[model samples]
Target: MAAQPSSSVFLETYGCQMNVLDSELVQGQLVALGYSICQTPQEADVVLINTCSVRQLSEEKVWSQLGRLGIQKRRRKELIIGVLGCMAERVGATFFDRMPHVDLVCGPANLDRLPGLLDNARRNRGMQLSLAGHTSRRSATLSRAQDGVESLDLSRASSPIDHEQGVPAYVRITRGCNKFCAFCIVPYVRGPELHRPPAQIVDEVRRLVDQGAKEVTLIGQTVNHYVYA
Candidate 1:
């Protein structure tokens, strides 16, 4: 029997270290699902842009990339385009209206649902979305138990290639921010601050160390405010 072709994905990330880590996790998820990472969008069956909304310039870059992808989508009708991270959370369904070529829109908080969303988008050839929205109204304890972010963090596969390259690994100890600074968009886009269990953080760090990670950086919107009750 002829071997099945392996699918490839091109993932571009913009913004902070948290987004970088998010991209790594997403890539790990895709890799686990048998998707190979490609260097260029034109060479892949799927394209994902993990975006930031902190500054207008950051968002402008995403717009430029989306415009390029829209042209690519016209040429390759089967290619999947996804927008993820804070921009996805901020824009919501408006992304589809503005960028009709995009097939999936998933926010940072909803990242655990991305694989299924990607599958549905691929199979149905339609829009798929996973956003935090008003669903974060649940109690902190309940959210921590139900929120899949912790599981997503715990499930991340430490990449030997990264370790060989001496890349500093990132560990997210908290999500979102409670400080609603007038100029900052983090609280609104990332939701309220939710600290991960210390045990999970320690486990993630141990896994990275076991994989030969020389440096590990803990990240969060308001990292100093992190506390587990």
Candidate 2:
């Protein structure tokens, strides 16, 4: 791993428990790569927003935050701004075209590439994106065998205890959804359902318990649909 230039990052999450887990895993990855977490966007060299697309209000909030970050970027040319999660997957490259200040946009399924994307964005001052796109059409068996995003969960760092809620943690047993309900965009943006190995799920839960987590929540788009052979 290339040594990151000393920098702090602020990640704001807006979504369900799944997105929360993604944000935590992403933070752990960045922290492992030498990035320090900051409490607010104003104090950071890198700012990322883990977004949701299930509601228009959630997307609007991301746009509003991006606008504020754009103004900040004008003052600090070196600041890096990124959009992650469902919104990035749904919007794809359009985010870069519409929000020129966003240096990086990564889909929920492509989060494993985020660290490299961030590194390139900061070094080259160019746009970087990792969307699911056609890759979402792959067979579940193929995805399970090749998915790099699985590492994001497997490599989770120590859990950070919530001062008020205690050490609450979330573990994703499955991802995406197979249900194509008329009003739902989850099937399109998050892709087909892929279940993690039952063994891995058990191991993750045990690990979280060992890490001082007092509460563990199992999450998924359609959690009950989870199945493994």
Candidate 3:
């Protein structure tokens, strides 16, 4: 391991506890790759905005944060910019159109490939390279990032943990949705539901437990109807 930096990252998490957990997961992964935590965005080399999109208003917040960070990116050329979680998947490459400032754009299912993609984006400066194609268009497998860990260790996390009982630790048990519910747009935007492997789901649960998470929530808009072939 490299020397822990006296200075470190400024990871601002938005949306729900799931997003928070995703941010922690990113922190844990970065720790493995030799990055330390930083308290303020003013003193950081990387600024990761782990975002959400359950509502349009929430999406706006993500963009607002991006705009603020855009200024920071201009000030610090080495300051990497990236987006994570729902909004990235929901909007796809179109996100670049609205916020061409972000260096990386990643969706929910692409979390595992984050470290590699982050490296790629820092070198190349692109969105789709960070978010898409990790799982493949027609593929229905879980991310390699989900492997090994049984559950997120809530206490071990460097940041504050939301100890919300009954709220399952933020785990994307499945991705995409088949239902075209009239009021919603996930099925149309994220495409049909594709459940991950059953054993893999259990494995993620175990990982979360190891991470200090007491509860685990299975995700997907219409998660109840999900089934694997």
Which one is best on lDDT? Answer: 2
lDDT by residue (tens digit), candidate 1, 75-170: 999889999999999998999999999999998888988888888887875799888896574246535458776666776673313664667889
The 10 consecutive residues of candidate 1 with the worst lDDT sum are 136-145
**Rank order (by lDDT, best first):** 2, 1, 3
The TM-score of candidate 1 is 0.93
Q: In candidate 2, what are the lDDT values of residues 108-182, reduced to their tens digit?
A: 988989988988997885799888895673457634457777878887653233423556888888988889899
**Alpha-carbon TM-score of each model against the true structure:** 0.93, 0.93, 0.69
Candidate 3 structure quality by residue, lDDT tens digits, 49-163: 7777768888888788888888877888777777777777767777678777777777655666666666666566455444444343534443543432223232234434443
Which whole-number lDDT from 0 to 100 does residue 146 have in model 2? 79
lDDT of each: 0.84, 0.85, 0.64
Each model's total of backbone clashes: 0, 0, 20
